[model samples]
Target: MKPASTMRPVRTAEAATTSLFHRLFPVNRDIAIKSIFGVWGAYFVFVTSRFLYVAQGNVDALFVQRILMTSICITSTWLLYRLLIAVRGRGMKSAIFMLTLPTVVLANYIAILDQIVFDHEAVVFDFSYLLKAVDFASFDWAYVLDEAFTRYFIFAGWGALYLALSHSQDAQRMMAHSRQLERVNRESELRALRYQLNPHFVFNALNSVSSLIIDRQNQQAEKMVDDLADYMRAVLTGGAQDMITVEQEIAQQVRYLEIERMRFPERLRYSVDIDQATKDWSIPSLIIQPLIENAIKFGVSGSDQPINITISAQSEGDRMRISVANDGRVIEPTARADDRSTGTGTGLTNVQDRLRTLYGQNASLLLANSKDGMATATIILPDPSQIFQDI
Candidate 1:
């Protein structure tokens, strides 16, 4: 808007770029045809421009003569493109060697066509005239052979270049397609692992609800049922497609504990300790649920006193740390991590499997315990920035 003159150059450059792109890459994605058109078109423009620059006369006739020459070159190369496509790597070495015959024959045809057009001031392809033109006393067979020799390489070189580029592009396209399929298959596997939790978790939650009803605690039972519905809704909806913000995950787990609170209203208390900086960070959804379940199962099975479960998230250098810890049992330093008192450690194993699937070896789940009646299950993500990048 500042000046029309200044804007004109930008618009002109954009138009030129678009025109060049269209010239190189045609409307349809035909690599063979596209390569021929682009290379030959560039060659024609360059050769014609050079001729016009260096020569002193006959600009209009030279333009027409060059147009005819370019048309012939395009047609000849197109036939080569078609031959390469049809052969498609069969007897490739022998086939290319045999192509020398056609290349040599066609190259001589170019020389003949040029001679006829120059003599008659018009295009002609008469075979009889070809015999007549060679009746000259000064006919040099040596020069013709030399010119044909050079032209042979030009034709052969063009065909070889096209094949190399076409094969390379095809390979690249295949590799990209393979990577996409791998991603889809991995996501499907993650989903299968995620859904494994549903049946086991629902069975436990229903049993807890049933216990509440038998104890004549109708109000707590109703509250737990409502919380369970809300929790399922949050999980099966938008946030469950493999990743969830630390904040959303914390919210979902809080709902889970609210249901469990019905069972141990006095004995179960939980806390969430998420740093403000880590709330928006993402992790695999429902990853921490199993650790919490194990905490309650192992911690409450042998104790009559209150147990405090804590969920915490914090940043650790380039990594992010998420832990579910409980005051249920002190993890003895000598105890195997997979060994717990009340269960077969399936919950911890499941969480560990999921972390390995999502982050490979770059992420880990660790079980640590302290002497002060504290047991911790922590997940360490080495690169939070890469966790949800693909998703």
Candidate 2:
């Protein structure tokens, strides 16, 4: 993910503006009013405490005076802040040009109005009377300057924080969209790969049948065609869904092997040891087919001794583990291995990719050579609860 520092400043400024307006309505408006009132109330109480000490107990009048001053301050600050934000993007020079004079004018107006409104003795907005009422000698221009700097710091700090927050929210939404697109792309590729397997396997099986027909083995050719038809039917059934029960997947594998069995009649054989519990589990459709095809291509198709392939599935704790082992030795570690008679390297590659897409890193396909003179491919994955519990 890109950092916020890399984000466009113009967009950030626009988002901040939007956030400010959104903070001013309905429930948000209520909150802002409450917050401003609370600040005034606290300042009013503080002023009343001072008046009680100064006048030796006449606190009500001084409390009212503080409320008027506090209200004037809050309203003036809010309005000034809005005006400044409105001109923020035109650069510091433009912002200062648009805001400084208006803000000074507003402050003077508020100062004079508070005197006339709160002090009924004052008949008009008089600068000298307002200055005297506020205690001119104790005005403290240095303190006023300090307060002005503090107000700017506080406002600008909040503005920066709100801008950062808005950027973070937008970044989260973007990341989620990107992740969704990646998932859809992966699923499309997997579906396309799954569909491609049926045809590739078909072409190979038909080619084998052609060879047998040329050799005048009409009976074996007929058996191959029947197996092909059954396999195609299974493909159609499984292709209709993204996933299928383990039992259905096994049925498809059996039909596929039957076709190959005809091609290498006495050279290939297989066994199954599926757990009753696993029969109800669901796996990605056509996932195991390509793995089985890979095993046959490398381990059974052209081995000197008649090859025996065994497929077994069982529940291991909360997960299902399936292993397919064939009686074909792995080439020596130091030797360069020859390509298998059947070209299915790409199929097995697709199998790995599909497994990763479906199960992330949790699902795995492992290949190893056992000391018992067999090459094995194992798939380990979580059992689908929907398939089991629903049934």
Candidate 3:
């Protein structure tokens, strides 16, 4: 009589109960097999020991019946275990209701089955008799409560064990997921730091080539192109790496300086002073290139006087201190706004950001004018051997 969209199949009480039972006790082949092995193994041992001691070597129908009843009890407990796991997180009240009701019903059902099928006694299934005692005018509830009480411990034990195992598995899964997310985030940050170096270096190098082309220095331009090709090959090869040794980094910077040398000729003179003890120390790749580019941009490009830039490194106890200094004329704070020579000026900031990302507070970059009037950029790195070990 209803529209097709509104039409719903009516579920009877018995059908609904069966659906709820199946939903709460969903079939898990592994858990089912484990329950059968574990529950039956323990039940059989207990029943066999009791029968052997009480029956005194006599095999009887009662002993067989007891074994069968124990098997039924174990089966019920395992089914209850499945229900408890399903009802977990559904609140304590729901869990206790499901547990207590099923146990009581199953115990009563077994008692009825024992009287009818195994004992063959005329046992009346009446609630009135449960309230009456052998003595007149006295009501005793013990007989009615005996079977349910006896089975409750077995079900409770199984429930406790199941809850413990479930909680353990959930904690392990949460820990694994947390670790996976941490690894993903660390990798994403490393990729971001790597990408920042490439474009900034390429932009400066290309700008130099463009300047040479404008000046019509064909011979020097051709040589610069060859040098640039070699420099790019090295950059591309090492771009994917997160860290490089001090020596490798210096070699890369030397390639960059060689290109710059072709442009400046006699106007630019630079030197690298590195301690032999710190050469194998690991540092972030291309970290120092931008500082050198900064030196070139502000030092040689802004001055008519020949500017000298120096990069020096030394070990200070557990730290490696590196400095890039240039003898360029310093613009006073008042002249900074009028100085057209201060380019986009992102190189120093880029170096600082990458240092912060890679080393947090363990590394630092500082910019200051030295005593001899040189614009000095200093970087202090943590102990490279210890840093590598930490990574």
Candidate 4:
């Protein structure tokens, strides 16, 4: 006896094979009946035409008899094909054997019917003549061989056509399934990148509120709490989408800046220079907020004089270029070992990862020192309308 564990895999494989067979050659009654009728109809027309040609356009009793006999042979051949499909289930070896075996038997049966029913000269039908007609000693073995080979090739051709159609349908179904899986994976990765931005922004905003409370600025702390509340609500609501219009994103950023301006009213100055044409363009939600937050933390916080932070966007052919710049101090190209700003490096890294996830290598975020003693963060993204059209 085989072990149960070993038996299970064999049974599973058999079941899967059976399922594939049914998918390839479905045996629905309506479809089978329609196919059989259509095939036999075509066969009837061809046989009738051949008989008319041989008889020289004569419509006589012998012609009618030959037509009826050929009809019976065609119906029998179709029935045999259906039976093979039912009993053998499309296994290549079994189907070939069963389909071919019937051809020889059916051809011999049709030959006997033709000889007895159509070639007889008797005015009255007689069983004695029919019996002698089918006798093995009198039968033409050569004729039977010719008929069998003809029918065998015809059925083989039919099987080849059926298999070709079945394979084509299977290929189409597999391709559709593969595309669906790719789409699902892309959506999942985009959601993960979108979620990463919220917590990082929240942590820094909350820290600023704590600082205000510690410095005994109660009025400013209360107002910052309100602004933070509004900002959190906007972020949470927009988090459900992978991208939003540039106008909406800038509004959220302005709310965030409102909270920061309260913390450094005297030393922080900011401006936005977005083109009117680019206002309705779409961008990854909260994509630029972290860059602005980084500017306030490192640029304004490290400076004694009033520092102006600027956010601007413009279209350059196929790409949208956005920059956030501050005049507080030049940012070092790399982080130092002991550097501890409000956002060490998490904010910038989060933005870079989100850009890569959304646009592969087409979008980018870069940080560099400007010619006028300011730190600038620039981002380039594909056009918003084109992105929407692609989706």
- Models sorted by TM-score, best on top: 1, 4, 3, 2
Compared with the true structure, the alpha-carbon lDDT of candidate 4 equals: 0.70
In model 3, what are the clashing residue pairs, if there are any?
none
lDDT for each candidate structure: 0.73, 0.67, 0.69, 0.70
Candidate 1 residues 213-311, lDDT tens each? Answer: 999989888888898889887777654557878898888899888887777878999898998988888788999988888788767645788988989
lDDT of 1 at 234: 77
Q: How many steric clashes between backbone atoms does each model show?
A: 0, 0, 0, 0
Estimate, for each residue in 117-207, the C-alpha lDDT of model 2 and write its tens digit: 4544323333345444454454445555555554444334433443345446557878989888877887787787787664656788989
Cα lDDT tens digits, model 4, 1-391, are: 9999999999999999989867644654334445445665676677667754574433454456655666676666566656566654457777667666665576666665655564455333333555553556665667666765666565555554544454565577789897677667767866665566546456767887898899998888888899888878787765786678888888888888887787678998899999887787889888887788778767777778788999999988778988999985555536532475344576787788777666767788988887888788999988654431223
Candidate 1: clashing pairs of residues: none
Model 4 quality (TM-score): 0.65
The positional error of residue 188 in candidate 1, measured at the CA in angstroms, is: 1.2
For TM-score, the strongest prediction is: 1
Candidate 4 residue pairs that clash: none
